[model samples]
Target: MAESHIDLGVVTAPSGVLVLGMASWIDHWPQLGGTLSERARASASIGGGHVHDWMCEMVAVRAAGDRPLTVRAGTAKSPLDGGPTIATLEIDLGIPWVRTAGNEPIILGDLPVDRCGMVLGDALALDSWTGDGHPSTDGLADVTYWGAHAEAAHRQFGGELIPGRGNQVRGWLDLPLDDAKSLGDALGDWTGDEQGRGVMVAVDEHNDFHSFNRASRTHPLLIGAIEVADCPVLGINWDSGDHSMRHRGERPFGQVYPVTLQPDRTGRTTMRWTIPPYAPGHDGPE
Candidate 1:
């Protein structure tokens, strides 16, 4: 018997999906030089308007339903039909491939789906823009839907899954920081720390050939750690340090092209996910 290399399934995009994770979150951390509120007051500001206006504009732009609401899903099979590791999500938001399950199951989905489900049934696309937001580099759907779903669950299960309606219960409706941190903290098991120390290091792809696939852009990419306690997330950016996922912080590992996400405040939200481990020296997974 040989290990199964691929598992195929249908994960719904819900026809109104926008960005995944905090992919479109604009950084407003008060410490990284200053918060978005301060940037508006800074003399260096070129347009002579409060930076928040741009953020508001961006948020509005993303919410206008202008992008696709499709999510790509597939599975990772083990050698042979060894079943699956049934990885439970301690903190999984926009997983690339997953299914809902029943009874006692190892994998999230009950049985392996051989075909698409009701979620995949294409609804008449009402518009070109599904909602305001951007997609993750890895292309996951906005998982902030968790909040809406959580609310519905609370009405039924009442204190079974989570205590309350995510950030709303966490008091993060209109935060001052980038929406990414809030989206992550919405998991309720994590805390966010902003960093002013940034870096950009080019790694040798060694003819990986996949290098050409990277989306090219001109924003200063920063490399820093978002410590979800022991799980430190390393990220890259190419947008003007304005959004979270777009943070072009360069990484050294060409091998680990890791990116996970969750929905942010805007419609084009981020669906948070996990990052692969990086080699560390002194500062853990920096």
Candidate 2:
């Protein structure tokens, strides 16, 4: 086992939510034991590589707002290295936003009581695992550590975890190049009073939509949406196999409306958009 670390840079968002990207490059894939080996064997049997190990992308700490919130990632057992893969909201040290990656991205932190985030495109990358090898034990070991950390954080900052919403919709939007670009630009601009109604849309290399979510602050904010666009069409390809939820199955020419972030009388910001329905040939999720 080897130890390594990479500084993922800093965040400084006043909105109290941050989205960070995690990427990994394994120098060598290690042989393993326990459940990791079993999973690795299964993956290899079906032409999979490095599907059982987890990667830590960004660690968030609650400290002074003026203090730089430096994000970093490291491997405890394997010699791995990666950097923050995307640009996102600055961290408002007042709130904690940490994320870990396995096959899918998992967010951990506290969010404003009234704010919500959404996920679009494939919210979870069930088959795309980063890193070179399997862990020595069942993946639960990492979970145990994270669980304890969560408990400690809870005790320090009292809050109960609440379940957010999840929905699976099957359809795609075919926007003109300009509209597509505008949508893409709006997705990156996080400045505004809109405290809630943040949407994370995931797409493929071909700019085909695959996942969508109205997520909570507890989940990674919105950076993942941009990263997913660069990914291969994992939802429909063999890489995802039968595990991916077919969220975006139809491609229809759709109009893109301007995304508006308006502040209400109470000074709270909210994002508003009227997403068009699937084209005539396609239907939304039942």
Candidate 3:
């Protein structure tokens, strides 16, 4: 049988349901090589403010009313690279069901009023904006700092699945670098579990201010392996340095060898990700 595929773009149902994923226009795309104020103003512009540029592991859907939902495992290609399948998930949304057969089924209505954020027959929505005023990125160019903020937002807004919530967790973790040697030692000591989990280590590389931003002296470097189980789409900036995704085991998965920035390219750097061939245990593209 042919494999199924889900449209990663914005999806809506006739029942007043709206679904927004990473591909949806949620936030403004940051411009490359400009003053913080200039960048902010450019982002606020209509054409500049919103773009489908984020690459993520998870897919978020907003459902409405008491209508049931159906989710199926399928392959989605990254619009950034247009290369290979990124990730697949299998889930079904329907009448309340129990995972185990023996345990007494819990009643949905019996749940506490405060806990039942999404009551039946109510519309569901997700607002990406936190409503907090944008912070100054003036002297800050560290990707880790931004990643930390993203993680914090996810936690503060009650996780990614909560309806009407503003934040979605991207699973960004920080690896403290104790010293110069620690960087090498950490890479050499990476474990199989980490590889299977598809963790990427980002290193800062120096670059010209024109290439990126005045505050940022270096481009972002990403290293490690990627798989369908991990973040399917690995986001990258246009001026980002060379990145490597190496697999340890015999089996092959999504891996980007080395993607370097091209100085000739002009305008804002478009968010991008390299797609690899679909691996075992993942659904192939239709």
Candidate 4:
């Protein structure tokens, strides 16, 4: 018997969905050269913000209907990280995909969705880009959505079983960075000590979700790692500096593509999914 895989799913235009781990601001660490309050202030002004790849387990969706579904989630926060890691969150599905289950599962929804996947958790988007802060190569805040926060780019598409098991949640969102130069400047001396560090959000054709490193607009997806002990709050701690997924000498995951975002004079930015439509390309037996 072969493992089952499904199409991840997509979010059209401004609205989107994500089953992300806890996310947080990148510059919240002093070793990384910034403070939580400083990053918070910058996040309030600049468009460039970074967050930890994705850690905990969270679902974020943006759509019509304003309501919070009651749930008994984890209230305990990570000793290392400040935010609550395990919690029952009210997941308001803007687009309900399946029927509720019998037992109260950690995640609720129909079982074994043949062609579609289940959506859990509510949507949380924090829009605070004033576009008034000065743009720098380094020291910029990352975008935050829902209570989970934000992550950046990289792309993948396919329609086969993702080679893993169990239910997987996936979705997409857009973010603005400090261009390649500013990003490069922030990287400074890349001795793996303090190289280009950031967070990103991505979903593949298999509906496999990923919150990986946010590479520079100019840097290649080279393999690297950073010590992430000081910043324990999963929501604000952006860089885990963990590259264990890739083997030694292995290239960074996912195919790097150019994302064209249009920012009107008003400073509001918009990006549409192009090649390989934003939705998952699931080609499994239906």
Best by lDDT: 2
Q: Roughly what TM-score does model 4 have, to 2 decimal places?
A: 0.20
Q: Estimate each model's TM-score.
A: 0.18, 0.19, 0.21, 0.20
Residues 19-128 of candidate 3 have per-residue lDDT tens digits of 22221121222222332223323332322121122321112222322443332224443333432232332222222332334433221111100100111110122222
lDDT (Cα, tens digit) per residue for candidate 1, span 59-169: 100111232232222222222232221111122222232222422112110111101100111111111111122223222211122343445433432332212222433
- Of models 2 and 3, which has the larger TM-score? 3
- Local error of candidate 1 at 52, Å? 19
Candidate 2 stretches greater than 4 Å from native: 13-61, 76-286
lDDT of 1: 0.23
| Reference-based lDDT, residue 187, model 1 | 45
Say which prediction, candidate 1 or candidate 3, comes out ahead on lDDT. 3
Query: Can you rank all candidates by lDDT, best first?
Result: 2, 3, 1, 4
Error of 4 at 276 (Å): 36
